[model samples]
Each structure stands twice: as structure tokens, then as C-alpha cells.
Target: MDRLTAETKIAELTKRIERHNRLYYEEDRPEISDQEYDQLVRDLQELEAKFPDLAKEDSPTRRVGGQPLPFFEKVVHKTPMLSLGNAFSEEDLRDFDRRVRQAVGNQTVRYVGELKIDGLAVSLRYDNGVFVQGATRGDGTTGEDITQNLRTIRSIPLRLTRPVSLEVRGEAYMSKGAFERLNKEREEKGEALFANPRNSAAGSLRQLDPKIAASRQLDTFIYGIGELQGETVESHSEGLALLEELGFAVNPERRVFDNIDDVIAFIASWTEKRPSLPYEIDGMVIKVDSYAQQEELGFTAKSPRWAIAYKFPAEEAVTVLEGIEVSVGRTGAVTPTALLKPVSLAGTTVKRASLHNEDIIREKGLLIGDHVVVKKAGDIIPEIIAVLPERRTGDETPFSMPTHCPECGSELVRLEDEVALRCINPMCPALIREGMIHFVSRTAMNIDGLGEKVVAQLFNDGIIHSVADLYYLHQQRDVLLGMERMGEKSVDNLLAAIEASKQNSLERVLFGLGIRLVGAKAARVIAEHFGTMDAIMQASEEEFTQIDEIGPKMAASLVNYFAQPQAKAVIERLKAAGVNMEYKGLRVEAGEDLPFAGKTIVLTGTLSQMSRQEAEEAIARLGGKVTGSVSKKTDLVIAGEKAGSKLEKAEKLGVAVMDEAGFLQVLEGNG
Candidate 1:
């Protein structure tokens, strides 16, 4: 095609792609599949590559994010981001309404009640329809510029529908489903899990690498406007409407109430229905709808007098600890659960709560038959927070850690570094069963139709002894079909899923192995370094330690794990079954003219351009070695936001200290 034709085609593709982005992100209604959208993007990219000079800076491709800033620049809000005073009860809400009415001289009024999403508050700025900046609500005065990271949130429009300048306030939040998925993935990787959706959303947005933020699938609700040009709204509700029209996501659950009684009713309704929502809501934000009335009410030194947050009461219940149940995980760690007298807590009936470990049980002085305060941790998982010593009867039994595995009768031992008592027997039936379950989990091999029930049935019936046995199940199709609840079609689907898992990356296989201390992140690191299961199996402790994130303990664990005859046999069987054992990700061989190639690079402090994980992965892809510490042997130290002792140490050691800008330059092969 000619350059003119290509240019016209690119424009058409950009328009269509932007519209689709709006439909999918802003409206939450996608007409086209992901594959179709990707094809359009690819077409535009191809055209842009062909007609390079015709490309525009504000092109849709910019949303993909190639510009990486080293650190976030500070942004001073044009208007101070004020906090809202909180009301804990209906009386408090009434008092707030009374004060507002008094200030407005008992004029006719309306209040907008919105669900207070538990998330990070951020400000977005636009210049002539183009999104220019985004920042956190730091101290309500200044915040770190997170423009690039914000752009990755598809819900946040890159350009306004109208060519008008505006500044809006929003809450960037991760949905409950996304949060659960993220935490599950993190748990599988053996990384520290985020406590709640709020923290996860905050962390995801703060990631310097836009790609990291993009992968998190974050959404936002523009609640209020900081400033707007060429427009005027009489009330907060009208401003929200204008924001929605300008391609910003506004929470649809907000209600405008004519009376405080109605507003209180709205708050009460949400307190009960909050859990039903896809995201978490901590409270209801009640604001005077009239912009004139808000100005009249004015602001205090810290918060707005016009708005108040009615926080929901904590959901807690007193329940009797009937008994302690010990369960073994795939890692052989024995967890103690509190079997509680069924009590209604939060949105569900709680019959059990996680005691976590012996430390927790001892710390809370929890005893069987003792009354305990049970509450949902982060309003999700039921947990025993405290024991009421006064309610303990003489018949209460002191709970003790199990001396042996309940399932396999093997001796349980507590490792020096660990708090939980673990069953060390590799061949223990409980460990084997749990290992099989973990291997087929969503974050592991991801084999479908192999849930807890199916896995238990397979194990109890002696149909499968190890993870490798799953691959060979196709040969036993008739036998599987003959089992209760297992039809021909069900067996076929199960076999198909198992077969499909063979093509998974070596990282998944490594994680599925249930190696001690090997999480999803560690698995990926080890797999990428070794490039194959055979290479990992042959690697020595010293070789394993050479990889970033792998330490002496982890190295020894991997070495000891691979040395096991049973483990090696399982891997061999899997290999024989045509299961892939090689890493399927990008590999950087020894001889590349990359700037980071063959260098021991240590990242210190917070990187503003990308997450530490993203940076490490990128460095590895460029054949660089990433380590946690700085030493004389360190070739380069990339110090980011708040460069601490590591930076000083790097300087003292005469190691090269590169700033974020320098790191970006090096990444571009300009170093």
C-alpha cells in the first residue's frame, strides 16, 4: 500500500481502537474479543513502522508505554486534595447534616451518597483533551507524578472526549476477583501476599514500570473534579455526570438524597450489600450536592465540612472454639484451624477460622471450649483474632501442636527458621495428596477438572500416585470412565486438560514440583536461568546461587530436592509422557551487545520506571545478573527513589552508581 493509504488506514485503526478501549474500559462493555483488538493494534503498529514520519506523539500506540522515567517527579495539585471527616454512626451522620443545614441557613438541600471504595486516591490532569499527568493524594498538597503508570489503566481515558482541560479526582482500585487472583499468584510464588484489595491496588499503581501496572488490570472511579475548564456544574452530582460524559468512569451506585433520612438509609443498604459488589467499599461518602452550598460550608484545616464518610461498623462475632483441626499443606507445613461453633460473621456463616500456626494460637491463648472473637481478616477470610479469657470455663482444653502428621503418622519437626511444625516425610500420604492438588492448581500446571474432590478421589482410589501419573491417565480412559461420577466425556476432558498442561512453561512445572521455598517468582527465576528442567536438575548449589533471588538456603533446598530419587523419577516419567521440560520465555545467550549483558546489576531503593520484579526480569532478558546486595563484585548499582545505605555502600565500594535515567539509557543500548 502507498504511504497515503497507510496513513489513512492507521488513522481509521486508531479511532476504532480508541473507541473499543472506551467500550471495554470506560463502559465495561466490550463488543470485540481481545484477539480482534490486538489485531487492530498490530495493524496500526505495522503501518506506523512503514510510515514512520507520519506517526503522531498522541497516537494510540503511546498507550503501550515505551517511555520509562527513572523516578516520579513531584506534582503540586492546583487545588489541595482534602480529606473527608468520618462519621461512625447514624447520630454522627445526623449531626453532620445538622451542621451543614445550619451553615446553609436551613435552605433546601440534596446530598450525594457514594460508596467509598477502598483504594488509592489519585488526581488526573488533562491539557486540551490529552491526558498529561496523574499523581497520588500525598498529604493533600503534593504527590509523586505517576502519569505513565496511570496511562496503563485502560479505564482512565488517555484523551478526553472534549478538547477541554480538566483535573479530576479518582480512586484507583483492584476488584475483589483481581485481588484474589493476584494474592493467589503471589502465594503460589511464595512471595509475601497483599493483605487486601486496597493495598494491592495501591501497590499496582505505584509500580514504576507501566507494564506492571497494566498487567494488574486496575480500574478507577472519578468521584469529583479538582478543576475544569469551559464547563460549569451546579452540584457535585452534575460534575460526576460531566466526568462520565468526558469518558471517565463514575461509580453508578451513587444516589442523590433530598433528606438526611434517605442518605442514612442509603448508607444502611450499602453496609449490608457491600460484599455483593465486585470491589470493596469501606463506607458511604455523603456530600452536599450543591456546589454553592459546599462553598458556603467551606473547609476545615484538614477536611471538607461539606462531606463526611459514614464508615461501616466492624463485623465481629463471639464464637466458642469447639476444637482445633490440624491440616497439612503441599509443603508439609501443618496448619492448625479453629473449629468454631457456627456463628454468623460478615456475609457468611463461619464454622471455622484459621489459627495460622502454634505461635498464633499461643499468642491469643486460644484453648478448646474457649469463647473467641472471630472476624474476617480484611473482611474476607475468617480468622480468630483474640480469645476471651474471662469466658473460658474449667473444662477448656489447652491446645497443643501435633507431634506427628495426622494423615501419615510420620513425626513432625519444626525447622529452625520456620514457626510452623512441618511433616518432613517426603513420602507422607498427606504431603503427596496435597502436592498433587498444588500441581494442578490455577497458578501451577493449571490442569482443569482436577479440583480437591477429584484429586482426593483419584488418590483414595489409587488411580494416581504422583503428578506424573496425571499425564498417563489417557491410557486409563476406560478405567477412569468406570469410576463413580466419571463419565466418558468427563474422563476425556480431564485427559485433554492434563495433556494440554504438558505445553506449559518450565516455570509452571518447577512450581508444580512443590519444592520447598520455591514460589512462582522463584520458579520463574530458576527456570529462566537454567532454561530447562534437565539443566536445573544438573545444576549444583553454587550454580543455583548464581541466579538472582536464589540464596544459600534456597539453593540448598533446590539441590536437596532434585537429589531425591523419587523426585527425579517423577520428572523422568513426566519427560517420558512428552511433558515439556524447557523454559519457553525469552532467552539471552552469552554473546549479545547489550549494555546490561554479563553485568552484575543490583537495584537499590524504589524504581519509579518499573517494579523491581519487572526490572530484574528485563535485566535477565538482556543477559544481566541481578543480585539483592551491593559488594565490590557488583558491576553496577541502579539507585532509584530514596536511595539508601546501598547507594552509599556502592559509592564506598567504588561500584558504578547509575541513576534511573542512566539505567533507562543503558536499557536503550546507549550506555
Candidate 2:
């Protein structure tokens, strides 16, 4: 065909294919058969390949996936993806309602109840009604960019019905049937199976290869709006309706209730109807319908006061405890696990449950080969709830904690004030292996391609012995390629990820060190305080204790860890491998005279000039802490437009208050 003809035809085909995609995936009404749709896509692909410049960004052909990404870029959310406080019983729901009513006074309150899909929480951003970016809600404030992967999910519209910009939050999930089919396919291919639909969905979205995510047949239910432009929404229910009109898949089961009682009833009905649905929902999310009411109710440090999640009671099943297995962790703590006869529970086949420790084993009175009741706690972890002593056979054996380390054959010792037996040998293979796994974990060094299985393989094959050894793996590219599943491309990507991790600033290295009593947050705090690894190594316990959040125990742990000769040797090796040792995050010079220094501040309502997170980061840079809620201890409250309870409380408590303009002035050092 001619260039003009091809361009016109491409546009026609693109529009037609997208309409069909929406009908089939979103509306569940397909006008064409699978083969017909595939043919349409093939025609579009051929034209697009011939006239690459004429190919539209929202073309349906993109859903087949694109070139693999080297790594996911970090995305800072405009609004934080805060988790909801949970309600397990009726009282918790009522209590939440009471709190909401108390905050709003005589104002009538309506609620929007939505099925909390058991899947990964993701944020989708659109520019002028076209899908621009999508991300995982990693740690609320930050997320990983998965735009390419998200575009492949057919239910997610590449273009909206109208031109508008917005950021929406959704649960990306795999249906039960899809999960089963995927696991069946994996089983046929001799690949490991996903534990459940939720896991399968999460794993699919995180894949660097968009083709894998596309193949998973993932779906999404857009529940909330993070940000909106060009138009306004007065209530959450209205917003959901608008989302539906804009070509987003808003769950049809959501209901608006006049009172908490009706909401409770709605939740109860869903409890029985949950399993009947193709998708899995672990709970119901109850939110104040009115946007104004939600603003009036304000938010706590972690979750909004206007919403709560009512978790369904865990599903229980009776199974035989076939055997017991124990494993050592990076911390040297030996944990016991129950090997159960395969039984189905909570939409997954259960063959293992956590025994936790010897104390838990004895407390539950568990015996190998005995019948036990197992339940998934929060529908995630499998745990033995009760043991049926009556069902125990004469051949049942009482399990005991092993005296020696399973991997290294070292004698195990119970530490003071700790229940789990520890393998004190620093050189224990299991300890080293687990530590290496921890080092390469997402929150630590974040080496992308080195998963648990790969780490274990590398360890067992004598390719790597310590976390420091990971930096040297590039030297053995040929050897890496020879290993199973590690192709030239895989080895290159893994090495690139490793090299990228080296520049991750001091906090990641500190966290990756597997220091006792040091978590991700603590690592950041320590890194910021010390400025450099050498400074941290030289810091005295008293210096560490001087920081308000660092307690004596943590201070001692830091001091002891840095004091060790082996630790120093590892640090030197890492430094030699071109790993960055200095803090690269925001840091302001220490000064008591700084306006926000040593102050506990509270931010309330919406700011016009900047996001809440931006304001918080500014305060943090100035050595001030931003907390939720208002109290006498709060040095100042930054009140924005529509400031609510926090503002009133600050006024009543005689705490100082600043408007957005004044806050901005102070941020500029002009106040």
C-alpha cells in the first residue's frame, strides 16, 4: 500500500483493535473471535513495521510486549500509597465508624465498600488521557517504574475516553483460573509453580520482560484516585464512576452504604460469596465516600482515619504433619518448618507451615505424622493453629531441635534472651548463604538478577562465598554463562545490575552488610548521621546513642559490627571494588539555629505549591521530624487549604501554626 494509504489504514486498525480490546477485556463483550482479533493485530503489526513513524503510542500491538528493560527506574509517588488499618471483627468496624462520626460532628457520613483484591497494589499515571507510567507501591513514598509491563495488561486502557491527566491506584491481579492455568503450564515446562494467584500476579508485574507479564493474563481493578486534573470529584463513589466512564475497570461489586451497619452486612455477604467469584479478595475496604469527609477525618502517621480494611477470617484445613525441617537464617537463627501432606487451603496447595521455633513446636504439642489443623494467617502465611492429639498414631515421632548446624555441622547454642538456637560460627555455610541472599535483596544492595535460587547456586558451586565476592563475579563471565540458565545475556544483565548497585550510596551498603539490630530505616538514619562508611566505623557507641532514634542496643550492635576485623576486611574489599562509601542523599549542615532543626512538625490538609512528601523531605533535610496527628509535643503545624482536626488540635494545644506560604518562606530560609 502507499504511505498515505498505510497511515490511514493504521489509524483505522488501531482504533478498531483498541475498541475490541476494551470490549473483550473490560466490558467482557467480544464482538470478534480470538482468531479474528489476532488477525487484526497481525495486520496492524505489519503496517506499523513498514511505517514505524506512523505507529501510534496507544496501538494495541504494543500489548504483545517490547524490548526488555535493563532495570526498573525509581518513581516517587505524588501522594503516598498508605496502607489501611485492619479490622478483624464487628467491634473494630464500629469503632472506626465512631471515630469518623466524632471527627465530622453532626455531618452525615456515607461509606464506599470495595472488595480488597488479593493482589499487588500499583499506581497508574496518565498524561492527557494516555497511559504514561505505572509503578508498584514500594514503601509508599517510592515505587519501581513498570510502565512497559503495565501496558501489556489488556484491561488497562492505553487511552482514555476523554483527554485528562490523572494518577489512579489499582490492584493488579491474576484470576483463579488464570493462576491455575499458569501453574499448569509451568509444571509442564518443569518450572517452579507460584504459591497463589496473588503471588503469580505480583511476580508477573515485576518481571523485567514485558512478554512474561503479557502472557500472565493479568487484570486490574482501579479503586482510588491519587491525583486528578482538569476535573474534580466530590466523593469517592463519584470518582469510581468517573473512572468507569473514562474506560477504567472499576470493580462492579463496590457498594455505597448509608450507615456502618449496612457496610457490615455488605461485608458479611461477600464473606460467603468470595470463593464463588473468579478473582480472590482477602478482605473488604471501607472508605468514607465523601472526599470532604475524608479530608475532615484527616490521616494518621501510617493510614488514613477515614478508611479501614476488614480482613476475612483465615480459611483452615486439617492435614497430616509428614515431617519437620529446620533452616538457618542470615542472623544465624534456626527456624523450624512443618512438612504437611499436600492439602488445599486458601486457594493454594499447602505442603508446608511455619513451626517458628522449638518453643512453638512444644506449645502447639506437634508430633510428626500427627494430624494438625493449618490456616493461612492473613491469607498469606500457612501456620499450624491446633494439633489433633486424638488423631495421632503410635508411629508418630516427637520432633526435637537439632544440636548441630545443618549446613556447616557446627554446634548450635541458644543465645541469651533468645529462643531460636544460633550457629555462632561466622563461617557456617548456611549463614553465609542466607547473608548473601539478604545482601542482594531488594531493600539492600538490590542486585536485580541474583534471586534466592541463583544465590544458592552460586554459593553451592563455590563461585561466591561472601557478599563482597558478588562484586568480583564480572571476572568470571564465561563461568557464569556455563552455569544452568545463565546465558550470555543473563550474565551481562546480572553484572550490570551488580555494577549499578555499587553506586547505591552508604545506606544500601550498610543495610546489605547484615548488621545486627539494623533495618532499612535505621541504616538510612545511620548513613545520614555518619556521612561515610569510614566515619561510621570510627564512630563510638556514645556517638551513635546521641541520635534520638538509635538506642543503646542498636548503638552496641553498630559498634561491635564495625569493630570486628573480618567486617573491616570486607569493607576494604568492597571499597577496592569501586563501591561508593559516602552518603548521597539530602543532607543539611547541622545547626541548632536552623528553623526546623530538632522540631517535631505536623502537616495538615492539601498544599497548592508542593506535595506533602516534598514538604516532608524539606523538613527532614532541615533535621526536623514530620509526624501525623497534633499534640502539645508538636513544635509546629503546617496548615494548608481545608486544614481540619490536626489544625484545630494544634490551635487548642497552643502549638505554633504556619500557613503554606509561611512554610514555603521558612523552606527558603526567609522566615
Candidate 3:
């Protein structure tokens, strides 16, 4: 009726929404259905739209997600996100305990042993209990600003239970269910699938758009604190407890171990039971119990020597090699996959492990009917770690590389410099599937809800025959709904995602197409130079090479890819589907808007603007390049405070140097 009435309405609605948010997110108990919650949010939106003056900055609706960030500005962490030392096996855990004991002398150190989440490390900042910022562990000093994206994670509390200004650290991970669903959706969209959960998590967090990140169904577990303004922590373990008490989602599996022996036993137990977990765990961290003891051990230039991350035996399990399936890649590389007996390993059921190459398979003497030992190298992929030759039956069939393309029966050939056997057939279904999967990968198209199962089902069902098939999926919602797990909501979400994917700018689509040899960085270069997907597809090999980062091999891949009738058809379908085939997004640069264009850069010290990864991404966007160390080849060194050996080396070599301020100027046009 009036402004006062609207204000009252908004206040009550905010309270109601907050309560429901707490129930669904914090307590995992929902009083309102998702649809009901959606309606409430819509009503709130409508109210806000009608009475703009009633809108509050602290509104729950403001926290859903926001616009795409051009780049992450660096924030100097008050306390460093130091990496923990690692331990492998029981003995390694014991050694860590012994080291802690010897360092602390006798003060009964009780450790906070936590599962080393095989996911991306992120930092969350809360100002007076209000979630304000979230960042990636770029270089442990500075990270990209991903606050909007981080808010999408339901597990990460938007507002602390109490008034506290604190920085919490944790693993941002994709659960088994989410990962599987993601892979399935990708399959349907002919998008490339994530190799493992860790990559998926990392990619999801790095998304420029928070909405994209939120759609991925990501979860997080706070494990440590960077800084707490109004709190005192007695022990590292106590700090974790404090985080939990304050309403931050901390990993519940953490335990306090008195002795290395007990820690070792704990490690052993997890090593055996890791498969039962929902997410990946690369290792276990053994930290000194007391905060004082941890401070005593101190830093060692880079990593803290006090805490060790004892990795579980890389999570290995045995499975029977049922069949050898070969898939042709976009690069024309033929990869053999070991179809295995469904065995649980590394938080996922292992049914297939990549053979990588014929050489690898031959090296392992992999044969059908042989028992195989599989492990996630970093607790990610189900790699055929080894073949159990002793378990091979007398009648086991020796596996051989396909002499021809399995999809089109074209003779398989290996590139001179490559170890892979490749099928050159353009019309190969497997290649298209693999290419599509790669296209939707986090590093590529980044379509949410698209995962392996959905892709395979779509392909098998003929709903998606090629990458172009994805663009048509929006037109086949009912057909997809008929498939298992493809509920109406899921189908609608998938269609909406597909529709959203079209507007993802040129570089993303370029990468999503799974162009052989054209990596992420290269895709950006192509997008910038060509400016349109049609132009990029029409570009010659010479044109590709003229774009920096596009080497001859990459050029050939681009040319060959565009040359394909099938690929061209897909592109046509994608274009016709209203995919934004151009780049109109922000290009952060100063002189020419190429922030890093033509600059040979070396990043040193702790950046306060963005994580090293975010910085790297920014550098690429600006057309600048970064080298690992200072050399004659270097252009400028962006030095933060305490920029160690690299600074010294830069000074010694007469390299042009810019302070963090100058770098920020170039990065943000601050000057």
C-alpha cells in the first residue's frame, strides 16, 4: 500500500527467507520445498522491484550470486595460507608425529588431523559475521576474488552464527553425486567431462560468473583460519573448533592424535576406507598440536615445516580388466580404456581407467581378464597404476592396439613425436563424444549439469550424435525426459544451461569445441584475434600461427578441425542455436587494453591483488606472458613485498622492475 507497508513486508520476507536458508544450507533440514523457496525468492524479487527503497544490502537474495568478474583483485592475507607437510603410509604419519614431538620438546601435542581434500584450496573472509569475500589459494599469499562464486556453495555459511571478522580456509569440492551428474550433463551437451573431481572443483571456483559456479552444486569444508579479528586460538585444533562454533562449515572428520602411532593407525584406516567418502582425499595432514609449537617450527621460506600432509597410499584398489575400449580424440590420438569390474576406489566406482597410450598398455602388459591395480595419482583419475601379472589367468587374452579407427574403421596411425595411436576419421562417434566432453569441461565450455552419464546416454540414445547435437538438446526436452534420471526439472535446467552456454563469449566456445592443440590460452588468443567463431572457424593455418600461442601444431589442429564436415555442421548448429559467437566482455588492459600484451613478466613476492592463478589468467587476457624465473627474456618483474630470490636475481640481471602498485596500475589501470 505504501513505503512503510513495503518495508514491513520486506522485513518479514527477509526473515522468512533467512530462516529457510539456515534450514536448507546450515542444518540440512528444509521446512520449505525448493519450489516454495523459489517462489519466496521470486516474491522478494518482485517486492524489491516494486519498492526499490526497501531493498537492503544485507538481503539474502543479494547472496545468490552476481555478475562475472573480469579478474580477481589481490588481497594480502593477514595470516598466510601455508601448505601443510605430507605423510604417506603409517610410517610417514609416525615420522610426522616424531618430528612434532622433537620440535615441541614435551608439551603433549594433540594434532588436528584432517582429510587432505582432493579439491581446490579457497579462502573465505567474513566481516563481522557477514560473508564478504572468497578467494582461491593463488600463491598462498594472494588469491583471486571469487566471493560471488563461493556464495553458491550451500555448505559455506553466508553469515556466521556470531559476530566475528575472520578468514577461513577449506577445500572447495564437487561431491560424487554432483560430479557424476556434471559429467552426465556434459555428455548430453557433447561437452568435455572433468577428468576428476579436483579439476571440476577448481574450475567451478574460478568461474568469472558466480551463477555458473552456483549451478555446479559445489560444496566446501572450512579447515583452518587465516586471521580472526576478535578471537584467540590456543591450538591449531582449537582454531578449527572455533571455526565450527562460529557457524563456518569445518571438516568433521578431523581428529586429535596424541602420538604418531595413533596418527599412523588413523592414516591407515582412512587409506583403506577413502573409497567410501563422497569426495576425493589426496592425503592426510599431520599438524603440530599447539599453536605455540606450530609457531616455534616456523616457516621455511615457502611451506611450513611444522605441518605435514601425509597422503593416503594414493587410493589404490583392484579391479578385473573386463574389456579394452578405444576412443579417438579430437587431436586424432587414439586412447585405449580399460573397462573394469565395477570396484569402488577414490570416492568413485572404477569401471574404466585410461591406458594413456599403447606403450603404457604394452609396458604394463595389460590383457583382458587380468586383474588390475588402479589408483588416483593425486586422488583424481582411476589410473591403471599397475597390472597384476601374477593374477593373470592362463587363458587371458593379450590386449592389442586397434590397427584401425574403432569408430570408422580407418587405419590408426601414430604421430612421429607422439606415443598415441590415432584414428584420423572425422566422422568417428567416439571422437565426437570425447571432443564434446572436452568442450564442456571446466576449462572449456563449463556447462553445468552436463556430465559423463548424460553425455553417454544422449549419445547412445541418438539424442546427441555429435557436438552439434548439444545445441539441439534444447529442442528435445521431452525426449531427454524419457531417459532415466532426466526429470522435467533436470531437463529444464539442462536446456537453460545450454541456452546460457551460447552467450559464454568466443574463447569459451572455442575451447568448448575441443580444438586439437588449441589449449585454453590459445583459445583466448584465437577469440581475441578472430573476434567471432565463424571467423575463427574460417581462419587458415597461417592465420592461426599469426596469433601468439598458436604454434604450427595448434594451427594444424584448428585447420583440420574446421575442415571437417561434421565439425562444421556442429558449428552451424551451435551458431543457429543463438550461441554468442563473439567476444564483447571486458578486456582489462591499459595502453592497448591488453593488460599483459607483449610484456614478459615475472611475478614475485605475495600478491595482494589476486592469486597467482588468477594473475596468470589476467596476464593471458591482456596478451602478456609470465616466465617462471627472471632471465634476459624477462620484461618486467611485478614484485610484492618480501619478493625473495627472484627479486635478487632480477636486480642482478638488470631487469625492469615494477612494484605491486605499478603492476596493479597495469592490471587495473589504477594510475
lDDT, residue 157, model 3: 73
Alpha-carbon TM-score of each model against the true structure: 0.53, 0.93, 0.59
lDDT of 2 by residue, 567-659 (tens): 999999999999999998776556546678878998887788976777888888777888876777999999998887778878889999999
Candidates 1 and 3 compared: the better one by TM-score is 3
In the predicted model 1, the residue pairs found to clash are 189-519, 189-520, 208-609, 208-610, 209-609, 209-610
Candidates arranged by lDDT, highest first: 2, 1, 3
- For model 1, give the RMSD to the true fold: 15.8
RMSD of each: 15.8, 2.6, 10.0
lDDT (Cα, tens digit) per residue for candidate 3, span 474-564: 6777798899987876777777667666767688788887766766667777777777777877889898888656789878978987898
- Give the alpha carbon lDDT tens digit for every residue of 1-671 in model 1: 99889888988998898899888876779999989988988888888998999788667776666554444455668677988897888999999988988766647989999999889999999999999889999757657788888887778888789998888999999998998898888899999977677878888776656878877879899999887667868789999999989898899999999999999888888888987999988888999998766755656767888999887886899989999999999999999988999998754568888888999988888778999888875466788877788876699989889799999999899889889999998888889999999999866887757889999889989989999999888888888988889986677767777877788789989999999989887998899878889989999999998886899999999999989999999999999999999998767764667777778988776677776666877787777877756678999998887666567778899999889998787677742
Cα deviation of 488, candidate 1, in Å? 3.6
| Poorest lDDT segment (10 consecutive residues) of candidate 1 | 65-74
Model 2 clash number? 0
Q: Residue 347's C-alpha lDDT in candidate 2?
A: 80
Cα deviation of 413, candidate 1, in Å: 2.5
For model 2, the superposed segments whose C-alpha errors exceed 4 Å read 102-107, 183-193, 292-302, 619-623, 664-671
What C-alpha lDDT values do all the predictions have? 0.84, 0.90, 0.75
